[model samples]
Every structure is written in structure tokens, then in C-alpha cells.
Target: MANMNTLAPHVSGSTFGQVIIDTIADLRDRRAQRAVYRRVYNELSAMGPRELADIGISRNNIAEIAKQSAYGL
Candidate 1:
């Protein structure tokens, strides 16, 4: 009937809205993780070779270390 047709559209609209909200939330989380990765990488890169060696981190591994620290991978 007419009422059923109207109700179906409303439900579909609500689901679409939820999908948009979820996408935005996912994007925000990814941006935050990327910021953390960049910060850690920059700080490590600024250290001298001797300082890095003191901490057992080679310059070549800075990106991997930062990724692990940020994304827990």
C-alpha cells in the first residue's frame, strides 16, 4: 500500500545515512593513526646515528618501527 512504500524509503535512507557516518569515522581514525606514525618517524629520524645505535634502532628501520608503534603491526 501507500504507507508501506513510504516506510521502506525511510528505512533505506536511515541505512544510507549510517553508512556515511561510519565512513567518516573510519577516515578519522586512519588520519589519526597516520599522524602518530609521522610523529614517531620524524622524532626518530632527527636523532644522530650514535643515539639511534644506543637504542638498538638502525636508521633503515625507522619507518618500520614507527609503523609498528602507530598501527601495532
Candidate 2:
């Protein structure tokens, strides 16, 4: 029979536990980014057209602007 240790992946190198942890951390990061996007969108949307234009953003661009603000791109 094959070696039992080699039959299953060595957790020390390619850890199943680490994969779970990475997945959870990725989910949390995505959630936090969404929250930030929502907050900026709401704050911008709350402003009047005149207010938005004065800041050089139009109402139609609120979503794009919020995304740029949250993602810095």
C-alpha cells in the first residue's frame, strides 16, 4: 500500500486549515469593501445636484465616483 502520509496532503505545507482561513479572510475583505462603497454612495446621493456639481460630480456619476473612492482606482 502507498505511504499513509503521502496518501493525504501534508497539512504542514499545503494546509487545509490555511485554505479555510484564506477563504474567510477574502470574504471579510469583500464585505468591508462593499460597506465602504455603500457608505460613500449614500453620502454622495444625499447631496443636492447643485452640491454635487459644485464638487465636480454629477448625480449620474455617484456610483462610479463611489467605486473609485472605495477602490482607489
Candidate 3:
């Protein structure tokens, strides 16, 4: 049989355990970004037309603004 160590390498270098941890961390970051985007959109949507105008945002611009806010220009 081939050498077991050469076949598997070190557990720390490339293993299912590290992959799972990285996947979970990535998922959590995505979830947090989505939550922030939702909160900002809701807050802006709650504003009346007049209130929004005071800040230079009109109803027509809400969608664009939300998109930019979520992911930059």
C-alpha cells in the first residue's frame, strides 16, 4: 500500500474540519451584510415623500439608493 501520511498530508493543511469552519464563517458574514441592507431599506421606505426630499432622496430614487447602499456605487 502507499504511505498513509503522503496520501492524506497534514490534517491542519487541508481537511473537512477546516472547510466546515470556513464555510460557516462565510455564511455568517453574508447573513450580517444582508441584515444591515434590510434594516437600511426599511428605514428609508418608512420615510414620507416630504421627509425623504429633505435628505435629497425621492421615491423614484429609493430603489437605486438601496442598491448602492448595499453594494456601493
User: lDDT of each model, Cα atoms only?
Assistant: 0.88, 0.84, 0.77
Q: What is the lDDT of residue 63 in candidate 1?
A: 99
Lowest summed-lDDT stretch of 10 residues in model 2?
Answer: 3-12
- Model 1 lDDT per residue over 1-73, tens place: 3545443353454775676687789899999999999999999999999999999999999999999999999
Tens digit of lDDT per residue, candidate 3, span 1-73?
A: 6756453344457776777787789789878777777877889999998899899988887777777776676
Which runs of model 2 end up more than 4 angstroms from their true locations? 1-13
Model 2, residue 3: distance off in Å is: 18
Best by lDDT: 1
Best by TM-score: 1
Query: For every model shown, what is its TM-score relative to the native structure?
Result: 0.79, 0.77, 0.69
Model 3, global lDDT? 0.77
Give candidate 3's error at residue 37 in angstroms. 0.7
How much lDDT does candidate 2 score? 0.84
